[model samples]
Target chain A: MNARAIDVRGLNKSFGDRHVVRDVSIAVDTGRITGFLGPNGSGKTTTLRLLCGLLTPDSGEGTVLGMDFRARGDAIKRQTGYMTQKFSLYEDMTLEENLAFVARVHGLDNRRERVEDTLHRLGLFDRRQQLAGALSGGWKQRLALAAATLHQPRLLLLDEPTAGVDPKARREFWDEIHTLAAEGLTVLVSTHYMDEAERCHDIGYILYGRLIARGTADAIIRDSGLVTFLGEGPGIDRAAHLLARADGVLSASAFGAAVHVSGLKREALEAALVPWRKEPFRWSEVPPSLEDVFIQLMGRERDERYTS
Target chain B: MTGSLPRILAVLLKEFTQLRRDRITYAMILVMPVMQLLIFGYAINMDPRHLPAAVLSHDTSTVADSVVAALERTGYVDVRYLPRSDEELDQLIRRGQVMLGITIPPDFTRRLLKGERPQILAEADASDPQAAAGALAAVSVLPTEALRHERLGLGAPRSTAPAFEVVVHRRYNPESRSPFHIVPGLLGIILSMTLVMMTAMAVTRERERGTMETLLSTPATPAEIMVGKLTPYVVVGLVQTVVVLGMARVLFSVPMARTPAGWLALACGIVLFIVGNLSLGYLISTLARSQLQAMQMSMFYMLPSIFLSGFAFPFLGLPPWARVLGEIIPVTHFLRIVRGALLKDQVLADMGNDLLALGLFVLAVAGAALGRSRTTLD
Candidate 1:
């Protein structure tokens, strides 16, 4: 083993009576991109915070970069760069000034040279003197990233870093992340976009404070045991509604012009679609996508927790 | 702690840079006290001058002229108008045109000639009680001095009877220069209000913006960050104290009873107290959610300090309950210490209780602030 960059296990965090993160365990290999995906209140941000020592877990034991997560949090924090969900930089300060402040805060030597290089590398050298508040969302994201990585931290924890960014800027940002990963920096990124998760080396899916699955995207899709059938023609939304309540149908969601119906039982899914065949609809069986598998997984987990 | 020194220096440099960018805050921090010193030095006067008086002279003769001369010579009263009737005098008093009304009896000169003790009826407008008392004192002295001359025959007036005596004593501030009293108290008020408010807002703004957590996650500990943030404000506060004291001396002629070194020592103690209070404000800011809430909390604490701290009013004049409330304010004790040392020339031994009170206040507030900062989650 090449020494995991982040090795946290059995992490538990609770905000009063509600458990935010429950007995979560995960590890990221050195220089690998790990995707954290979950619903809105699924503890992804909390887990990311715990991994970077920004928050102290209520209970559990772990190590980040060979430092004890509980005992040597300061050391872990010093070696990690965290980009918050919001655009958090001094709005009154110019782009160059904000970067310089971060550099000075970390006590980086040769501050002027380092700030100059970081600005040039991020393609923000031309807009260096513009105030941070005036920058577009894409430019602000670049500035935040530059500030975060200025200290050359060993790990990067990005919490929904591309929430408001455009597609082109997001693609460029991912390219930058991959470039940094190539230089031996581990990245733990939480994202809602499925394409972004597919780009990661491995994925962890969390639901309601619990880690439901962890594997490659293809592996998770296959392991879900979801069999999906596409029904395309008129009245797909109405058909999707009928299919959602049908026996043995786990979930039915509209994917573009077609309704994708998925279930864990292959024979039962086909039997349920027999009534739909009476209408003028083109039915075709297809390999279940990552989205279909996750929908079916969410359906099964929701029933398991709620019914019990 | 090998790299701690450099880190501290780095933090200090960063703070100064930020402060430089906040130009409005910097101007308020540096210029307000000096401007206040100039305004209050000239505006506040305890020994009021140019008070208007109405004379109802039934005996409109040379004796009345002589009485007006004596009143003018005292330099406390300005005889504005001579009313013909007592009704007119009453109208003048009611209209606030005159602060005092003097009625010279028709037999005023004849009474002195007959060797009878004549009393001039002097009615004063007591609406503004302090000015009223001063005006009455000025008018009464005029006849008694004239009577003494009449009995002794010093300047050609001869009399058979002696005159009643009048004595006056100015208390608290004998010279009655506003700066002498106000400047010393201002030292306490300015230091406490500005230092506590500024530092509290700065800390709370960072926390609201989520920058405190980012700053804390660095190698800096809570103590290191606090000390770094506090160092510049202490310097700034001391500079302001010196500026205010220097302006008081130049503009108001407020005497500096102690030596420069003594003033410097007092300034250091006051700066320490201010920093401690500011730390307490920081703790309050941490508990508050936003800057507006932090400001409201600061004002809530500040109102009692201003009213009960004996800066604007005399502490001894307050009731017993108010006195107890005054004792609870650190600024109240600090004002006494600074004023006693600078104005009254009292030594440290004479101000032992005040010094102890200030020390206890600083220690208690600082201990609570640091404890809260460590325990609270940002």
Candidate 2:
């Protein structure tokens, strides 16, 4: 297998007059988990679909799984698995039936054995006869995971797979994803949660169909060049609201009872905090967090929009 | 609970906005009833006209010619065919190109001039017994009715009893039972019901329940997905066919096919009709964006089929426009093919045109469906 399981270049898609995904390109190294983080409708889903050959790009072309993805879509589809943003297994069908159907659609041999193995591995065997609709949100996600992966796809694309799942179930799902990646399956997952982004081996942050930042979590935070000040005082929430409009302050928000103010100019941020530098309010410069960096990125985009 | 009225109203208003977003389905729901009312009200006629008939005249007498003319004057029957022999007449009625057949005996004029009773044979295809009843009754009185005319020089000289006799023959259903007609028609309706409704929901249900994205992501070709979706329905259609055919036979004692060829034709027709209907439903599934829309469209197709395919009314009685609409629907042709093969014991050659038409219906619908089923999410 090639080192890059997913290698695609310059992809574009539009629905009618509105362009949804434009001049986009992405590649995933084999056995790596790439987290996609963006606000909703940033074309994360659209790009994933384009990469998987589900939606045709208007102008770009590349290869997926070493095959010409656009021309040999069926071949690429045979080796790739996609889990949708919503739980998409048939609600009327039982869990066992859903897996078996996927297997049959993929034309896999020993379908019964494969279904049994999938159910047993996922610990969903007891609920094999239960309808997918009857399962809870977490269980439904797990079932969808099982159904998508039954064909032993070389690449897996998950769109917000843990959105409604509980923390415990979410951790377990992540653990399973990691386990599969370790077994040489390349995975690209989209999520909005900070903790989930931290768990990914690499991260890509998109804004308005444009990929603005991409690196490991640490690399992105360091490359952001953002300086944050921690303010814990009696009225930090009020201070945060005031600081948000101050010059050189990129973003200001109350994190729990503390106020987090981040900016590119550390001296200017300190100068702006002169009025609140008092006995009750203690301000200390700290390293920027992933969340703080993301906020700064969004603020930078807003700033550019205002200036333009 | 009473205090929640405003909140309930808020949700209701939001729901209305959502409903409006589904513009096609909402518009269709409003349009369906009015279209059905107009088509059924103005177009369906229980009393059919221009019932096609054929003539075989072995007698070259004026009496025989006048008798044939009298049958047409009844306004119920139109002589569309001049058969060379009994064989050709049988072929015409069996194929349902003509519903009524008149066979004048060679010795009818000779016997009538000698003051001896002679029979003028009139054959009516009784598969749809009611369709032929009005015309058959009129043909049975043709000899006396023709003789009563003073314009006929030779026939007027003889008394009413002196004229030749007319004998009526009811083919297909010897007793003219209603079930014989109804049972065969039910086959067409039942096939349309199960095949169209079931296949219509197949893909739309996937989309509504959010499974379409996952389904499309897989390596399965659109053709594979469609065939997999339709295979189970084909089996269901077969079981339905057997059940309906068995019940029709046991309950109504509908006549069985006289030859293996007729049975083969019936089998081919049922399979074609079922497959054709499934393809049509698949086309609808691709067109509709929601399961509700699919159901509405299915009903939109079915109502016209039931009304215009001669299920509840005589097909010949319908106006030309309604008949043209009926011709496009697969059920109408399947109805004729099934009834002809089972009731009239028509072979493939007899119902060839109908079978060919059904094939065309399948190809058109299936081709459109495949074209629409591109893997893109457009």
Q: Give one digit per residue, the lDDT tens place, for model 2 in B1-378.
A: 999999999999999999899998788878988998888689976677778888898977665567668877888888888888999988888887787898888887777666676777888888888888866877866766765663345553546463666678889888989998998899899889878988998888888887888888876678988998899999999999899989998998987777999899998898899999999999999989888888889988999899888787777767889889888988899989888888887889888889999999989999999888977676
lDDT of 1 by residue, B86-197 (tens): 8888667644457677778887766666556566777765433455567767866764565455445534346433442223223234455556767877877787778877
RMSD of 1: 15.2
TM-score of each: 0.74, 0.94
Off by over 4 Å in 1: A278-280, B1-172, B347-349, B374-378
lDDT by candidate, in order shown: 0.76, 0.86
Kindly report the docking quality category of candidate 2: medium
Compute the lDDT of residue B250 as modeled in candidate 2: 97
Task: Write the residue-wise lDDT of candidate 2 on A80-197 in tens digits.
Answer: 8899998888899999998988998889999999999999988899999999989999999899899878999999999999998999999999999999999999999999999999
Across residues A162-181, which tens digit of lDDT does each residue of candidate 1 receive? 99899999999999999999
For model 1 chain A, give the 10-residue run with minimal summed lDDT: A1-10
What TM-score does model 1 achieve against the real structure? 0.74
